[model samples]
Target: MLKSILLFSLICLTLLTSKAQSVQWASKVMSFSSEYSDPLLGKEYRAIHILGRPSKYPKFSATPSAWQSLTPDNPGGEFIIVSFDTAKVVKQVAIFENFGAGSITRVDALDENNKLYLLKEFNAGYAQANGQITRIRLANPTSFKVKSIKITMNSLRVSGYSQLDAVVISDGDSPIEDRIKLEVDPNAYLVKENLGTAINSKFNEICPVVSPDGKKLYFTRWKHPDNLGANKNQDIWVSNLKDKKQWEKATLFPAPINNEENNAVCGISPNGKTMLLNNVYGKDGQMEKGVSLSFLLRTGEWSFPKPIRIQNFKNKSEYSEYTLAPNGKVLLMTTEMKDSYGGKDIYVSFLKSDDTWTEPKNIGAAVNTGESESTPFIAPDGQTMYFSSSGHVGYGNNDIFLTRRLDDSWLNWSIPENVGPVVNTNQWDGYFTVSAQGDYAYFSSVENSMGAEDIYRIKIPEKVKPQTLVQVSGQVINQLSKLAIPAKILVKSRVSSDTMQIDYDPYLGDFSFMWPTKKPFYMEIRAKGFVTRRENFDFRDQAKYFESVQLLGLVPIEMNKQYKVPNLSFIQSKSEISKESYPALDEIVLILQENEGLHLLVEGHTDNQGDWDENLKLSLERANQVKSYLISKGISVNRIDTKGWGGTKPLNTSTLEEKRRLNRRVEFSFFVVQ
Candidate 1:
């Protein structure tokens, strides 16, 4: 009896599952309201396409030409009301139309009780010149049991007729949740707050870039009265953060940075000292544009913008918009290059050792589609990328999407996910940037706002926030003169050997670098006429967000001058040097090679802990060990001399272990010997 009852229960469960799997389809539309129908073809064309029937003239309809064209009585807006035989829960609707003529701009639906509901409104710029199909997902999935759909078309152009090739309605009653979810959960509260009137104006304000310190906000304001181009071009504007929530009134960037040309701010480095600006101008009767770089001088003035010449950017068609990764090692840009799925796609190029860019590679299909993708912003973590795409299934045209690098390769990426309705609306939404902390995102939107486009800030959802990043920053100065020097800063990943090189501000001596957390890095600071500085950072156990400030001081290369090697280490009490000491020794080898006429004396010292005689012997051996390593690196042995001073010259007399450790060291003194 128990077995019979169990079998009956199993049978009932299978029946219920099968019943749930049954997906219903709406019957063909009984009628449609049209202003003027073709004499040869009736309204049957609309119902036939919705019913998945083949077009009567498949060859001629390649450009979304309809079997019957509906013309409004006058040159204005018109609607086509498509009614179905039975009410169906519509999950999504795909509308096919001609690209060159009047197109559908809005859609509304009527429920079984004749109650109408507005569905979605497309932006004026949403349509392309090529015949294409747009899929509009209903905002409320549960409220889609509608009997009719009204597609409204605004005849903004001279064309009097709006042609509809087909309409497809996807029923949401299917047991499988294959449809793209559009509506946000009721409990999910995400609001996009305007930056307010202080920074936004009646003119267009876009491309917001917040400094890593979160103190300054920079953006581009177009058609402002203060613009140098008679309110026709764009200029960079900046505002300071007040109490974290409010912004001071924005002021136009001064002369050199904002000129008569169309100047716009694209990106700001993590240190807030370097900025990437787009300069658009007309040359030879054609518009020419490129991204220029500028530095913030110590005198609170911006340097003149200089065009960044990428070695591999010979093909102008492939490169459009670009942003530097926080580390400045990689450049993420939009390209219409070959092998792209279609239209403009996001690509990446790495900075090579020769200060040139590598050939750009597409970020892959997971993040791109047959439609256009643009405005890419790589977060400080370096792995997370936010961009805009019309190809992906999104809320509407050019919705913002985020994707993460799955691995070290540019092509390996996670599937792109829409950032959702809080940040993306039905209109054009793009140019998104996030703060270094990953808490708030700043982007331009065309919603109810102060201008045609205004900058807005929204708190990012915790789940969508970027991974943590750590910044390494400081000033590079001359040790003896205590004056700022122009230097090249190189940060290299110990594991991957990937390197990022940035130039320090010559006037300010300030430099900053950002990298994803939990990696070991080696940094080298090099400048002419001075000894280079090298340091290492191990952040495997560091907290999520970390900032390391290091003052890199360089000693001027003078005859008979001695400088302590910062990181040369010896094994406990042995003469053997640690492998971690190689980077420091390599700098010496580089200095010797660069200055062929120089001679070096390697001096080693010990703390005041061991026997005098033994310490002397050990220090001599350690000095010779470093000398031998330099010889192995092709430095002439005759150019180097070694010496040892036991405990006679201790750096620190403190009894603390950490203080005493600093007393044991290796020093290199160089002189010109003709």
Candidate 2:
């Protein structure tokens, strides 16, 4: 049994000490009756069912003798108040009558003035004759709007009583079209060639499947011009998108796919790693009544197609096609169901971690109607669903419908709409599959064709469409000298830690990668000659055209040393002269500027070397030599502190030339946060 789980919706709440904002309904009631005579309100009013019982109608028409209200046990007439607000349009209307099939005379939607605006009175099916529920669908009804809906009843030839147990009215809206947008100007390129002959051979052509990186395209061709098989034969063919925009002449996809039997390619994984197609064959080894589902693997040399056993394939007439999610776990399919709305509805089955398929479940009434719905394809994000519906409102035949997944449930599904004059005419418009980037829409259409439905491509506008990726790019460079540096850069998402690493060309010093554009990420770089650096980039807050490039200056580890040198020099005036010591102090200034984190304590010392008081004064003077150079080079004084240790502490306890040299040296250590 399929599990029926109740859904919890995310609700926005506002707290209030007193009774917060809320609605108070006087009461809830459902009124169901079978009679079509008088209008209840204006032309807009059809049948009114108020929340609470109101005063009786001024002139209530006699209830038809054949009409009766239904409850839980009687099987049809239980009407539930799904909502009490005004509705603009009713997409579908369902009713249950007691008399078995062919029991009702007619069902019509009338205005409050008793004028019929729309009607759908079809022959009662087997289920309807036996007191089962019957669903009636109307074409787009935008000509008039109403708050109430009326259902008129008429008995069969032998005028008998008509009973209604429940009435369900569905709110309707038009389905949204696939939107595709170009990142750059459209003048950037044009279709060098359509390569229609690749898949067009005087037979029906369709289902163009493009590879992940936008390199290869796989499509279905029938009665292929290059085939040795009989006429009306079908085969899978592939074409390459060379030089970015040009599609190479298409050819039969490698073996095991272009078999003697009719093989139709349905969809391909974005990565081009797997393909799903359906094949029909019989004992004669040609197109037959028996159609088997299979998958093709791109194992270096394309492997033979393998059959799928998803527990739902029960008959030769049962149809099934695979729609692979970008992540490769969700598989959307179609099959005839005993409990289906009508002929067929799309279903989804998830692949478990153990590699087994789960039981398939209907996409539910939100997307599937009682009429046949099939050809399911999910956008790369796995949030938007696109399919074809014959029962949906459109220009003609099958029209495309799209619905988005919200929270854990799919809701707010737009009604199916015609793709306009370009993609649809009076024929079937389906078997649609789109690229991850949402740039191109490929489907079977009979447009400027040599024969039956030829594969056609349309560009999806960007504003309201889906996208496959977010691009990130930046430069590596020396922080202090402002020079570009080439290094290995790795971008890791804080949540997933999935790393996309790229090495900058030693000369170019630039790197970039296409990161999934929905999260926070950090970039880190490591170089052999410099310090490791890291930067954080939050894509969530970035603009649509965001890009980043950074420069890092690596600090070289300096050695601690002891040295004897000439007395630090002071030039010109007595208070501001240190000419001889300038070169050595300049080197220290460069080091500090290169490594921003570096801080140093400058101490002055005299060679064992002098009178206590006189040495102290001289030591201070030498320390000033280092400080002045740093100040001239933009180094903040707060970062450098000076102290004098005059002749007090000596090195090596010796008075030799070497001892004096050691005692006269300068020293500094690194101070920085980890």
Segments of candidate 2 deviating more than 4 angstroms: 1-150, 155-195, 228-232, 279-299, 312-317, 408-419, 471-516, 519-674
Per-residue CA lDDT of model 1 for 565-625, tens digit only, reads 8677554466778887887888888788777888999998888787999889878887898
TM-score of 1: 0.64
Count of clashes, each model: 0, 30
**Candidate 2 lDDT, tens digit per residue, 1-674?**
10011101111122332433222111222334422332321111112222211111111111121223332123232222212234345555554342432444345443434344555655443342344445655676535543444443323322333333333444332210001110223331143113466546577777667664556778877775665466646677778887866677777765656667667776665434456667543344545322233433323555555544455544212566667665455677766555444456667776665666676677664555534667777765455666776543343456555555553333334333234444444467776666655567666766456678777776754433554454455566666666676677666777763555565653532444545457577776665545455566766654343334444455434433322223443321222434655545554565576667766666666665546787777667666666676788899877776667766765556767655655654444445545
* Pairs of residues clashing in candidate 1: none
**Cα lDDT of all candidates, in order?**
0.68, 0.50
- Estimated TM-score for each candidate: 0.64, 0.48
Off by over 4 Å in 1: 1-183, 186-190, 224-226, 280-287, 311-319, 352-356, 477-488, 525-533, 538-548, 552-578, 602-628, 641-674
